[model samples]
Target: MKINFQGAEIHYSIAGEGEATVMLHGFLESSEIWEEFLPEFSRYGKIITVDLPGHGRSGCLDEIHSMDLMAEVVLEVMKTTGVKKANFIGHSMGGYVGLAFLEKHPGMLQDFMLLNSTPQADSEEKKEIRDRSVELVKRNKPAYVTMAINNLLSPKNTGKFSEEIEILKERALKFPTRGITAALEGMKIRTNKTEVLKSFSGNKILVAGRQDPLVNIKELKQLAEESGCGFISFSGGHLSYIENKVQFIKLCISSKK
Candidate 1:
């Protein structure tokens, strides 16, 4: 279904029934990415999957869709669906949105987990990389999406998931350059949320990938330990939900602190 927000259409899907649980997908991905796991996840509670602004069927709301803006969109979805409080699971960029949500709407969150994501802001070097990616997307979107999705997977599994990679690329290619650049710009400016994690009064989980190229697993593990949040790791890369589905599901299910 779609919710009209700020003159843009925000696409979302709802399944099953019980305590609400929201699932937010990463960059270049849509709510569809969670389709395979929805049935199983819904067994736990009502699962709501959302397409971030400028992603999937959702429309871009601004030139730069900040993490805070995306969080507000999620909040609107919850309100539309009559969800007062819900657990959250966010992957990559989606995790950044989750932290922003916590910062602004603390009372609405029952708990949250960051999957292959961090509470830290983008480093200068990473911001430079995002700048480069923005330019690349403007010049050659398809090529950039292919390379970006490939880089998200573990090198060892690239060949193993070639067909899956192709599908992902096709979906990512549908994103407009404007949306892509806006997302990159937003990510470049996000503030460090480590303190947000430390001060949260409810449960939190930090799931990292041993071979993740995008996140520093050691640093994230340290943050999790320091903040007293549960930490889990797997032999995979950034896309642990795809690379290690079974274990990832178990970890998420057990994250209800």
Candidate 2:
């Protein structure tokens, strides 16, 4: 189904029954990524997936789709489903949106799992990379997508997961220059939400890949400990959902509470 958000069309999907579970995809990804795993999730409860602004079938709302903007869109979509609260399983950029949601609507959350993501904002070094990435996306989106997706997995699994990488590239290549750049810009300016997670009354979990190129697993585990959130470490990289699909699915099913 679809909804009108700030005059832009936002596409979302609903499946199964019982408790509501919202799965948010990472940057350059659409709700389509959850198609294969929806069956497992739906078996336990209602699963809701939405294409953030400028991604998937959704239309772009602005030149810079900040986390707050995307979080608002998520809230609007959930309300359309008549759900006042839902479990969160957000991947990468989606996790950023989830943090934004919790920060804005603290009482509207049941449980949260940040998969291969963090509540920390970008450092100056990362911000520099993001700015460069934005320029690269604008100059040549296909090349940037190709490089970005490949870098997400552990270098050791390059040959083993070639097919999976190809699939990611194929879908990511469909994203528009504006959509890609907007996401990068938003991430670049995101604020640190470590306190937000620490203060969340609901259950909080952090799932990370041991060799994630984008996120520092050590820091994630430390944050989890300091914030009193449960932490799970998968034996792979940033794309744990793809790198360790079986384990990732098990974690998702087991963590549903």
Highest lDDT: give the candidate number.
Answer: 2
CA shift at 128, candidate 1, in angstroms?
0.9
For candidate 2, give the lDDT of residue 56.
93
What is the overall TM-score of model 1 with all chains considered together? 0.97
Could you tell me how far off, in angstroms, the CA of residue 42 lies in candidate 1 after the best superposition? Answer: 0.8
Could you estimate the TM-score for every candidate?
Answer: 0.97, 0.98
lDDT of 2 by residue, 161-251 (tens): 9998898889888877898899999999999999999999899899999999999999999999988899999888888888899988888
Superposed by TM-score, candidate 1 places the C-alpha of residue 92 at a distance from the truth, in angstroms, of: 0.2
What C-alpha lDDT values do all the predictions have?
0.91, 0.92
Instruction: For model 1, give the 10-residue run with minimal summed lDDT.
Output: 248-257
